[model samples]
Target: MLPLAGERKNAKGIIFEKAYSRNISRGTSTLKRGFAHMLKNGVVMDVTTVEQAQIAEDAGAVSVMVLDKLPSDVRKAGGVARTASIRIIQEIMDSVTIPVMAKCRIGHVYEARVLQETDVDMIDESEVLTPADEHHHIWKWDFTTPVVNGARSLAEALRRIEEGAAMIRTKGEPGTGNVAEAVTHIKKVNDELRAIKAIYDSGDNQDLIRMAREFKVSYDIVEQTARLGRLPVVNFAAGGIATPADAAYLMSLGCDGIFVGSGIFNANDAKERARAIVLATTFWNEPEKVKEAQKMIDERQSMLGLDVNTLELRMQERGGSA
Candidate 1:
């Protein structure tokens, strides 16, 4: 459950204080980001139905994201994609003990508002759905529910954070079943972080300012990220991850967690695949354990991967700009 408004301590020992005690708003950055912190090193799986949500929970998913259609199905449908039904979100929330998340089209503030009112544990201003606005994204701080946004680079991630996004996920090409783009994104973020870290270590404020200007984000965030050597929020890997090896590879790349969409349900062995992914993600550092997880599902049962280079719709580009 989300922490209620007040100076209360959560189960993980994160203290949530009212940012504005006199105002009705309840979501402080501490509360929002702390919710994401609790999900680190776990898998967040996408499910369109209550049964699938149960399957994910049984398979050890830390949370379930409710969607109207899987990312692959949304790609094939080729029309305006929107938020999941309130009934379905409510049903899934009732069915699962773990946190429940739902997506709203990028920049759809009202959709986010509705999800918050529905008492969802988290809201994803996702690129998987057709974007509702092109020039802007929702100012997430206005809402009491935490928001997670996707980013392809450090600059984009910082922009989202500046707009009050509590968590960030790599904007890998969704529904493609190809992990290449996801790998590329995380690596790029890592490389950029290293660059900024080196600049900060050299104590070159001028160069840091230049880098911030180039990245098009605030200098404070850039410097803070440089000082910390990582994203301020939990950074998860999403999009085209189909195999246990794929999950483990992303984990090795320093992702805090994984978000599986269209990978498990699109395959022939959802239950087994889901469990395998969870196992691989949890024991990513142990090679033999990962190998055992790899053997749990047959390779032939995997989803047919799409070449991201040839995709007609590049979902990752949605809501990319500040």
Candidate 2:
């Protein structure tokens, strides 16, 4: 538990335990509030520019994920921060009333705290790109604000959820400009969860959580939802989301929402792509309406191009058994 370096200290003569207890007891359930809003319409937009964010909002995205710059720093230099300036996030928030999310480099709760001050709706502790905080993952439960983490597999997703992430996504392999990887990963996790529900009743939520903790699950989150209790927020697919059709496919497999990062920006038709995703989520499961989303992206999102191969391998190594 590496405490933030500058956390304000108690007064010199303050009665330590009593004062701390009173304030902490009154602590706000910010995470729950955040989760509710992010899941309101079961769709979220991940965008690299303010213009893209406006497009997403206009198309009815439940939330807008803002970034500073994209693709260039990511493809050539591993990954970099999407929100180049706080002003970019502010501008997007100003442009729309829906929830707005900003990413914080992993293990940097202090930065997350700063974003919280900005009054943004949520903070995604996503490894969309390589993190600035080196190897340390952010401790989700420790923050006063709700923080989301990405998982490549069910176990990993549960691990973060156990650590108190308000929401989780399929780990986005940045700069891939695709969605196939996310599609397959999400499908497998959803299937695994449904199977668990088949084997054990939903009444045993506590039992599933215990198993998750004992086994140290680390990847997919849908596994936990089927095992544990229904989550307060929708489980969504993130990463490699290249088109609206891909978004619809994920929703069909039981995802409540979808997160688009590079997928929306790289299409050469950012506005149309964003609209495709919003509409796909809007009528995702209706067969007749679904066909209209077919060409959101004709190409598949390939995992082979990702820099986070080790992260991918970590989940593949211990593939779950249904």
Question: Residue 311 error for model 1, in Å?
Answer: 0.7
In model 2, the Cα lDDT at residue 63 comes to: 83
Candidate 2 residue lDDT tens string, 1-322: 1211112223121122456446433113333434544474466766666778778888777887776655323555543443446877888878887788888766666677778789777787756444556545666555555667776665665556655666767764555655666777776666656655653574565665565565475323434356453443446787666666777777777776887766666656666567767777788877566566655534443223454453332222121221
Report per-prediction Cα RMSD to one decimal: 4.8, 7.8
Q: Report clash pairs, candidate 1.
A: none
By TM-score, how accurate is candidate 1?
0.92
lDDT of each: 0.90, 0.60
Q: Please report the candidate that would top lDDT against the real structure.
A: 1
Per-residue lDDT of 109 in model 2: 66
For model 1, what is the alpha-carbon lDDT of residue 5? 21
